[model samples]
Target: MTQIPDVAVHHETVVPQAQQDITDGGPDMVQFVDGEGTRLERTPANTPYADIVEALTPEDGRSMYRDLVLVRRLDAEGHALQRQGELGLWPSLLGQEAAQVGAGRAMRSQDFAFPGYREHGVAWCRGIEPEQLLALFRGVDNGGWSPSELNYHLYTIVIGNQMLHATGYAMGMQRDGVVGTGDEERDAAVMAFTGDGGTAQGDFNESLVFAGVANAPLVIFVQNNQWAISEPNYKQFRVPPYQRAQGFGFPGIRVDGNDVLAVYAVTKAALDNARSGQGPTLIEAFTYRLGAHTTSDDPTKYRSAAEVDIWREKDPIKRMRGFLSQKGYADDAFYASVDREADELAVRVRTACQNMPEPSQERMFDEIYVDPHPVVEREKAQFLEYQAGFETEGAR
Candidate 1:
């Protein structure tokens, strides 16, 4: 048997950089605010930041704010439901709201989104109802909405699978003559959302290779939230995630994932580049996950509370709310209204989950094949017969 190198058997060390250069490295990945909630002006590297923020009207700001709040609330509710045994499993997007909402908002109506399972915020921005998200968790359906309807693909549970799908979709868009007509309004692009963990998968690397070769109109948004299950980010790569893009023949950007403004600006620029036939861009949103990997995992066993506390200070919602208040964009009434909306949404989600009807056994076999397959038909019939026999025997 060939022996695999044991990482645990080797000692690891951190590379130290000079503080001044590292500190002044041009806007800390285009951040509008630091982790301490300090606002900074745009530098030459972050020049597009101002334009993207300027593009947002008061209405757009309100919509983004609403998305951030409602999505988080919905996520929290889902976590609770999972703990209560109403949901089979739940993945909390706890500290990564800004990354999802900003990039999601940057997408055009016609642009498609291929998302990992934690993209509830993206789904919300794409017009998916909160109730529909719960269906996946409640064992009611695989997915609730048609991907064609919203241009948002179904949540892909197999990590990095959606990267290939997004790349293929972008290739199709290119073949359909949708790339580089210089019409930003009508041109289509693709945004593939994946996590830090997914970046290690072979499919992700292959997708980037194919995307680079084809010059596909796709934006690979990687949310590097520090921890992939129990493993730390340091274990995944020697350099940062964004730096990997250079090897893939695309411009790579690192962004403060907790900063909504930065995420919006960078993603918008990437999308614009794709629409203009500039090929793929990789954006690594540097953020932290303040929750467990899923409802089933106990993060406490692997991580320290001190690390969580540090990230909580950099909470995206809090930072955004601070900005809103300071800019006089939102008042106490606005906060109250948002809270009420969240409450209403929670009620609706709970009701939907409680009332969702089980799909008929016959319907399960309906969409398996486009053309008739006798073997599958026979098996489905036999399974239904078995189920019917159990019911006839009074087996609940």
Candidate 2:
């Protein structure tokens, strides 16, 4: 039995047996950095992906750092907006910045991505404006952008449903002659984003069966943020996600989710493998969520403050910034510039969110039916009448 870490114990003795190398993501995990922002020496397990990281220029590293900063700022603004009652709810991607940005930046323009509701970082990397995402959370639109235009699907609220949609889309790509075309511009693949908790859902398992059997061009990226809402990884499954992929007849790899360089290298290789018709691959990003699951949640009820503090030491943005600084890829000026941009972005997002026009009251009824229906019309009339009662009483 794998011993679980007991938070009730002293901080020094709180390490889990399964997590002895947690700082470096274990032997089975691909990692590029130690938790303190220092890069790790290449090892046999990570040697396969070393070239991808090696080929990245200093400018590339700086760009990724910039992305990490901006995405985190966008998420912070969203959380603040929810607390101030500006939005109905908001899911903050507080500690998953590196995992999303690295994977997002690795994709080619021709590739498509299907994401869970918390993939704001991926949306940013896909050229999606923060305002568009804010619109959805503001309850102003189903989704503010066109999926076809951006190659990013609408956020899937039903847990693990997008995995099915992604697999079907990947299969469709296979039918369309886009996979293994031997043309960099022509070959395309699909990526599906979900969290560890989603692996328990039937849809997730079913999608894997189809993807593996058909050898579909799909990459299932699971961000194991230590908890699915309030449940920890141990409770979700006896086996980790990456290990389970082998049972489905494909390769699986675990990466240090907080290490952007490692995440980028592994994801790029996986995408390339899929595009080349090598079939599906599962990537488990081992990371932590340092915030509540959502604005409506209170994480302190289930987890310990000591646990949160431990993960805080592994902050993704800080790690990237440290790498850039040590390598002299980015100086003080560049860091300052990114910080200024993040602040400006936060202001812009806040203004746009507050200014979103309230959708027409009749829009609910209009959206429910494409043409016209007697039942919908009757309900709409009754709703409008009921709403007008306050106005009638105010007139007195």
Candidate 3:
């Protein structure tokens, strides 16, 4: 069960006919249903909010359920591996699968993705190999994939660093004339994902400034999971996170992060707008972090069991399951099949982790310089000689 929030609906009329233009119309901030699973069916005028039940197709509903289940299982298995000392640390995406998968699915194959460290679900959605991600946690590699290979940049561990990278890439795309002109394949966009805590960093804000001024085809998808290592959402913003984007002169939307339909719809619209030369959009996926910040942090120390219990009711997986079951798109057998697939994936991840080999010392110095550098050459020679001195002492 997942808890729903109590939101009030206010209606207003736009008297000016000119202002009612739908082309440049604003988003509908929708809040229906309470945290307790009670439903509300009213839509305020001029607001873009839609009911979750009405927004999804049967297939889409089933897909969301499967996405949540598979991602959560992967996260859980990764955490278990960390505890077993197979991984140095793992960031659990236990509660945020809907936000990642929904937004990720909105991207085109040519569009690029910039992810923070915890966006394993986004990587998964982008067809990144699970072993490639595990290699990072296992300390066998910094990042194993090339950005051009998958249209996804390497995961940024430093808080808020990837925002600048995304903004810069979007600017390059704009300069290369890779955006607009109605060619969806050539007209591409970039998505930068960060968290609630990252919003406080200067890099995040600077990226927005750059993207807005350049009219870069980029979407800043902020996953507001309500905690930045024990700091609650209220401590960071008086209003919603999306409201901050208005200062940058672009449309900003706050959607139900747990509602996969809402995330997909909102992100798809945002990316389409960007690709069409409409500039940037900021989307705040309002969700919760149902697990520890990482394997090392204990939520029990800072958050109450009551709080956890409340969020548990609003589990994204459960909501999608409910929708799928109600729509007759999925049955017990379907869920069982998904579970079996996830189990197989877990075994694959484990096997991959066990087989990862240590990088050679010579390879580290090889890629450090493209052209010949005398200083680096001297250092490499000295390093090898120093190691050679200890060869008999079991140093390699």
- Which tens-of-lDDT digit does each residue in 1-396 have in candidate 2? 111111111113344535654334556788887777787898866778888989999999999999999999999999999999998899989999999999999899999999999999999999999999988988888677989999999999999999999999999999999999899999999999999999999999999999999999999999999889998776777777888887888888889999999999989998998998988889999998889999999999988887788889999998998888888788999999999999999999999999989998777777565688999999999999999998999999
> TM-score of every model?
0.91, 0.91, 0.86
Score each candidate by Cα lDDT.
0.82, 0.88, 0.79
Q: In candidate 1, list every pair of residues with a backbone clash.
A: none
Q: Alpha-carbon error at 28 in model 1, in Å?
A: 5.0
For candidate 1, the clash count comes to 0
Per-residue CA lDDT of candidate 1, range 1-396, in tens? 111111111122443322122222133366786665456777655665567767677677667778889989999999988888888999999999999999998999989999999999899889998878888888787577889999999999998999999999999999998888877677989999999989999999999999999999999999988888997766676666676777878877878889888888888888888987889888889888889999988999977787788678888988888877777778999989999999998888888787889877676677677798998899888999999898889965
Which runs of model 2 end up more than 4 angstroms from their true locations?
1-24, 367-396
Residue 192 alpha-carbon offset, candidate 3, angstroms: 0.4
Where model 3 places Cα greater than 4 Å from the true spot, the runs are: 1-42, 45-56, 372-375, 394-396
- The model with the greater TM-score, 2 or 3, is 2
Which pairs, if any, clash in model 2? none
- Candidate 3: tens digits of C-alpha lDDT, residues 1-396: 111222322333433322332112134444343333344456551134353346567777677677778788888888999999999999998889988998988899989999999998889889888888888898788566878889999889899999999999999989888888788778999999999999999999999999989999999999988789887665665545577787787777777777676677678778888888889988888788889999999989876777767677877777777766665778999999988988998898888888899876755566566698898889989998898878867854
Highest lDDT against the true fold, candidate: 2
